[model samples]
Target: MIDQEDLELKCLGLIYTMVQNHLSDKQKEVKAELESNKAMENIYVFKSSTSLVNDMQVGKQGPIATRYAKSNKDISDVVDELQALLSKNSSKEGVTVDG
Candidate 1:
């Protein structure tokens, strides 16, 4: 016959294992959700940035070009530099930019 103390210890150990496994599974789910959210956020930011770039390209020929030609050129150059940096980093991470 099993001793009562030994039986209780075994039961406690089993419960602890079950709880640990459940927590581990929950942690994995949370991590996956966070990764998915981050990817979605990155996509949103990329789209917005590209849209801004397009708008700026158009603005170069608009009234802003005449009023602030030098400033516009400087901002366009900065945008190009940042885009190149983003492209380099994204390529290293296996992300392709369509725009």
Candidate 2:
């Protein structure tokens, strides 16, 4: 099994890359400013939307899930990212991921 700390670094790496690639530095600065306060909210920022439709057609109500981050709140950036990816990749809003 992978060390959890290593996994965490990997996750942070990915998240950092995502934020860097998709968001403007101004946005990153804004997000950084908000991070301290948002951390207190304890909201679950849902990520990773697997298409429930195809599975549902066969019979399934999904999480059909994947974990994008364990740190949920300071996630507006991630949410922004997933939205961009979805818009880029989706047809008929086939991929409905939220976080």
TM-score of each: 0.33, 0.22
Best by TM-score: 1
lDDT of model number 2: 0.42
Measured on C-alpha atoms, candidate 1 has an lDDT of 0.44
TM-score of 1: 0.33
Instruction: Tell me, by lDDT, which candidate is best.
Output: 1
TM-score of 2: 0.22
Residue 28 Cα positional deviation in candidate 1, in Å, after optimal superposition: 50
lDDT of 1 by residue, 1-99 (tens): 235455643211100111121346777686457547843453322211111223334664553442454545545655665577668778999997654
For candidate 2, write residues 1-99 as lDDT tens digits: 236454643222123322223567888687667544655244333343222223323434432223222223335546675676556556455775453
